[model samples]
Target: ALNKRDRIDPLEKQDSWKDFIYNPRTGEFLGRTAGSWASFSLTHPEYFLRLWVGLGLVASHCQNYNAGRTFCQSRMVSQNTGSLKRYIQASFCLSSSSGYNDSIQERNDLCMVGEYTTQDNEPIKKVCQFKRSTLRQCSGLPDPSFGFKEGKPCIIIKLNRVIGLKPEGDPYINCTAKRATSLQMQYFPSEGRLDKMFFPYYGKKSHPDYVQPLVAVKLLFTKEDYNIEQTVECKVEGSNLRNDDERDKFLGRVTFRVKVSE
Candidate 1:
């Protein structure tokens, strides 16, 4: 019964569509669709919990890492300690990897006394003599293999170089097993003693022909000594040498692992 002119047509209604399509004040269209609005309103409680746990774990890991770094920095060697720190080192004899020549005659043909012509205006430093014959069976003279083929191996120990280091008292090499076990080893040159004459090595320019002293240890391995690795620690004992410092593990000692195959 209503007149068509008086009733409002749905298509002619402007407010609903106008605000969604365009803004008069900003002169811009409202771009958010129904799907975008739903996405923004949605909430995932489980994902929020997971994210919080992950962040907490990352924070804890970073804190622990910083603490460990600080501790290690504190344990670093002090700047006052000079480079003149002396120690001992062990090496395998007559092996290709050990820098020894594969030839029998060439490697063992070294002289006891090094021959060098002193330079002019340089002080003549006394060069100590070290004969390879002193090593006896471990010298590669009697057996070129140094007893490796028969399960015995020769280990050579040498003192680290330090200028003006005159070892007071007699310095000797002593080796022992790591565990509460015994290892049969024979030292060459008698009682593993390092002669006093070998001390006080002058600089290379002053003593070009100087030869460092070496102590050879011949391992007498039994049947039980094969296949399993044996840890050995050798220390040089003297008046001034120290091998028991917790701060410096290898102050005057050396450690090595050896194994012989049948």
Candidate 2:
């Protein structure tokens, strides 16, 4: 009797992309993808669906069905953003991207702030307009002499608060709105940043060495590209690193992404 079992279950028919009244017993459609049921198909699917669960989006099922993932590749595996925010606030350690024991040790082997040792620190936050004039006004930066004649004033950026060993602005940097999702923000260490790396005065055999604080941070967001390059003041409020010998330096500036409304 069971030998007569259909090669394709009724659920498999969901791949047809045709609507039908759902039946729980005869066949089963995945509740996750409301539009279709689950089943093996005659041919490979050229297109698929993705769902946004707030934290991340699902692209498709992994090819290996029995790979034994929670939803069989139906989930968006990612680093927790909350943790990222915390790490932003936590302790940090840095080193010269260049190695220490090189022949030009004095030239390239300066000790710098190491990796961000902790992400548990209090986070900084900010919101800035994407428009040119508005973002310039927000950070009290001088208005640009040329570029987009009129700024996209309606644009905005929402971000976690940040900190700085030294602060150029009290809060967040500005952004550009009404543009593509790609956005970039550039900064000089004198004012704001994520982590400022200080080069140890390697050549300074004497006590009064010139070791200026330098910060380097790179941020890419998957949201709004509101303001492209206007500077905004990122607000920083947090305690210093636990060790007095080392400073958990955060440059008080960031490139931002728009937080879209649901």
Candidate 3:
């Protein structure tokens, strides 16, 4: 009876702790506990030690264990690093506006264009419409047509390269302008306007119809004095952004100094 019990105990332990075998729903605990192993080891130290060493050898032979661990670690690192790099690449640039040297010093120029009459002799105020040709034409020449003067001063903020964004659905970006009490910033598109359907750029070589998007911001000076110089900060917000820190990290920001003259 004792010999029979001994054979049964070994079989029980083997069935309980089979490596790599587990129930997905309930989870696997191997069949027995450490206490049971301890009790059996006391009676059969040689057998228990042999089983323990053999299990270790088996585990070491399994390459999937080490590979899985390494894969998980690599994935975590890539995610963190990729997020930071994408945030850095996203940026904003002033594409077209009024005042200063349209070609050389446009970015630093404080002069803004005011309201003026067009070829049709119609009154045009508070609107600065910029197109692709406008940017190309104004690129290095001091063109007053691109300047933003007093009553008609409007600045166009172009959304530069945004990385890690996929172009599938309609994803848009929201922008807010921070400035002094007398200045007002208005964004075009009425709502968040980056339109993900056009983004996640597939490179010019791949997609021929892809056109870079732009954001229009009209700068309004409400003070009595028309001639004033002040700095305005524009922040671009996205749906994926979570907190203030992420905004500062991932989103793009642009600062413009405006001086509207009479």
Task: List clash counts for every candidate, in order.
Answer: 0, 35, 15
Q: What TM-score quantifies how close candidate 1 is to the native fold?
A: 0.55
Off by over 4 Å in 3: 1-147, 167-182, 223-225, 242-251
lDDT of 2 by residue, 1-262 (tens): 3465746566667744333343444353443233342222112111111111111111111111121122213321112222211111001111121221123234422233432222233142111112212123221123111111122111122222122222222222332333444344433332333232221112222312222222222233332432233222232322421111123222322223222111
What is the TM-score of each predicted model, taking all chains together?
0.55, 0.18, 0.38
Model 3, 1-262: lDDT tens digits are: 5685467677667655554265344454354455764566455322211000000000111222221112123211001111111111011123222221233333221212231212133232122223333333222133222223224333445444332233233333333334345455454444435444333433334433333445445555554524554555554454443224433432345444444444
**lDDT digits (tens) for residues 1-262 of candidate 1:** 7798888777767765786686575454565665554454343111111000000000101222221112123321111111111111112223222222223223332333223223345487655546666678766667654555466666666765554555557777888877667898999878888777665656677766565667877778787877676777777877766676776666677665665545
Worst 10 residues of 3 by lDDT: 49-58
Q: Give the poorly placed runs of model 2, Cα more than 4 Å off.
A: 1-105, 112-183, 186-206, 216-231, 235-238, 241-262
**Candidate 3 RMSD to the real structure:** 25.9
lDDT of each candidate versus the true structure: 0.53, 0.24, 0.34
Alpha-carbon RMSD of each model: 28.6, 22.9, 25.9
What lDDT does model 2 reach?
0.24
Quote the lDDT for 259 in model 2.
29
Ranking by TM-score: 1, 3, 2
